[model samples]
Target: MSLGFAYAAGFVLATSTGMLTLLGSGEFPPWLWLALFAPSATAVMRARNRQAPGWLGTLIGGGALIYGTLVVQSQGASGVLIGSTSGLLGIFIARLVTRTTLKHDLQALMLSLLIVIAGAGMNSGVSYGISFVAYAVSVVWALVTRQLVEGAEREASLPFGATLEVTLARRDIVTPVFFAASAMVSLVVLLSTSFLFVLFPRVGLGSFKMAQNSGLPDSVSLRGSPMAGGSGAVVARVKGVSGTQIDRGLYLRAATYDRMTRDAFVRDSELVGLQRSEWARLAHHEDARQYDVFLQPVTDGHLLVLG
Candidate 1:
């Protein structure tokens, strides 16, 4: 994919995720959403063309589908289709409007942002009654002025990995000396700023504003997926009370359901009530027994290695 379209798709994912949190029923926390976005976008960006990879499609499309299902599963196909379509449309439009042959990375990034804002604004649901429209418009206009209206012939930005391949033999000798001096000056300035920031007195302006409260959010990191050809084995190992060893498998969690509207899970409730606690207690009892049978020096990564 072109850099412009790649960036545009990333922007759409971010925007859709944010909007879902803001306007939908249940919620996935921002941090988890960010984690999800990273791999999902990377998969989409790096996916081989000709025939798009199933893993890429599953990660990105499945995520959006899950979000849609959470929002309105009960609302039937209409609700699911609308939410899913909205996300898919954002990507489709981004790919359609971007030029494929842009050379510069910075320029491509700027152009991608421009495309996102322009495309987003065209969506009445996104732009309507939003105070940030002016900001979006100004950003778009500035890029057009710089890259298009101004007629700058700057080289299209190259991806970092590809840029590293340039041979030093191509360098002009005088340019090296000039660049060295510039680098020294830049290093000194950076050190001075760092010193000042560290030594500067920190003060809090006495103004405190409460953030708007929202729903409980959770996410599964892209570390593993049992449905995606995984071994579904234990992620961690454990030691037991006796001379026994217990692998981190054989335990399963019940599915969690979020508050549904239309076709998606819009809000997730905090686990509460006697029924919830009872379920938790029962699970705890089972885990306690499992943990008591593992051996020493069990390597479980960062997963909950229960004692």
Candidate 2:
């Protein structure tokens, strides 16, 4: 029963990681949710009557990995997308290994670690931090339970096959004291890690920094300015406006589309390979005023700047 709990916790963590990755992507497709949930649901249903079929699980997992790879290839492999794909693959492998092996408690936990790593990679919001804490607590419970179960099996002096049938008394391991101790340990570890993270020095990457950018769409709408008078409704609210008494046209360039087709403006892919020095030269200004711009979420993931 403890082993079963551990497996269930691991599966839940993996699912949560996948969900967080999808949420971080800022665009969720219906099929992505289906792909995430279908295999786990099927595995649960199969576990009720008999052992999960290893071959079937492997097939499902392999299909998901392939599909995730295709998505990364087509979508330009952002950190969140990479993490999402890794979580999916981890889920598949966890399911396959758990169904195939009798001594799979440790294996499932290890596979769940992959999901945790993926979650770390994809995290951007406060919710992911909460999920991280939950995952950590679950892991502590799983590990403690697994240790108790293994100790009990070792003490019984039974054959390996007979040990599988050995049952542990709830009072022996699942007592209130045990839970409190585990929770305390988990909390201490969490606090220590957070403290260390806070103390770590942060460094910034300058113009040559490499980061993934979302692929550009063919056409973009050059809408009217947000500050225009007689607009229908306010699309965004700007704060911290002070000492601005100039009545002039303000243009914020989000992206440059150099290739125009019959119906849409496409990005010139060649421009991306330009050297840092070339870009610096092109962007040089004799008297450029620098100010921070805080933009709310938009459909496309492009940086908007005013020159």
Candidate 3:
């Protein structure tokens, strides 16, 4: 049961991490704070060998569905998504309170995964990455414990008229060796995943963010110092196309300057949008060097090109 509880803790960790991510992304409703109590309450009941009544679950589910319907008029399309997830939230909580059944556990796990995937698409920050890593670790831990628990249940299957009683300190099951083994196994899983991530890189895991800017200023000012260019951070990486060889030194144009000053080069305040027809009319030279430029995300969405 201690091992089972440990697995439950992992389940809670993964679910909570996912919910927090969704909340941060503004995809999840703020009512998540109250919804969290269901898992916490279920965990407590699981530890005490108690099951919440069936009617209570029905009431919770029904109430959630009703509330979701009521908010649809005010919230619009997002309200519909919120309402559906909230309804499922009740079902998820209901499953958590039930006895150790794979159906119940699997359903809850999948639901948590749904939230996690949604969260992954919504945010691209260090905190979200940390949460995802923690979620991954907890998922691994939960899966291991879940398998062990199922085997234990099968072995200790109770027949009619037979009551099983278990009384043992946590230290008996959760020994130092158990923890050491868990840590090593977790480390191995993390390292393996990290290695694969580095090798294949990003392979369509999440949605593409529309934000294409970095933390640089939109307009340049030569008011301060004579120095040009930005802090030594990389702006873009260039690679030659076909069999073409890149020159050792080349001037990469970012923005064109209309006027030059003793202090700094001044860029035109009024900029015109380049139309498709205008781009097509430009002269095309066969001898012009061609290279692929991979630019990093920046706050200033400016095009950096090599001539």
Q: Candidates' lDDT values, in order?
A: 0.37, 0.52, 0.61
Top lDDT hit: 3
Q: Model 1 off-target regions past 4 Å? A: 1-58, 62-73, 77-82, 89-128, 131-135, 138-307
Q: Candidate 1 — worst ten consecutive residues by lDDT sum?
A: 295-304
Is candidate 2 or 3 superior in TM-score? 3
Ranking by lDDT: 3, 2, 1
lDDT winner between 1 and 3, please give it: 3
- TM-score per prediction, in order, is 0.24, 0.52, 0.54
State in Å the error of residue 82, model 3: 3.9
Give candidate 2 misplaced runs (Cα > 4 Å): 1-28, 34-49, 77-80, 83-103, 156-166, 203-307
Cα error of candidate 1 at position 162, Å = 18
How do the residues 133-197 of candidate 2 rate in per-residue lDDT, one tens digit apiece?
76676677767766766766675675653353344433343656766787788899988876666
Top TM-score prediction, candidate number: 3
Q: What is the C-alpha RMSD of each candidate to the true structure, in Å?
A: 24.1, 18.2, 15.3
Give per-candidate clash totals.
26, 0, 5
Q: Write the per-residue lDDT of candidate 3 for residues 171-191, one digit (tens) a residue.
A: 366555765676678678878
For model 1 the TM-score comes to 0.24
- In the range 1-307, model 1's lDDT, one tens digit per residue, is 3333323343444333333322322222344334324324443553333234445545554565566566566567656545554455333323322323323223434533443444443444543324233333333333332343112223224343223113211233224354345346545664576566656524221122245233344542222233312454444343443322212223322222333344544324443222232223222323456343232221211122233
Give the local distance difference test score of model 2: 0.52
Minimum summed lDDT over a 10-residue window in model 2 is located at 241-250
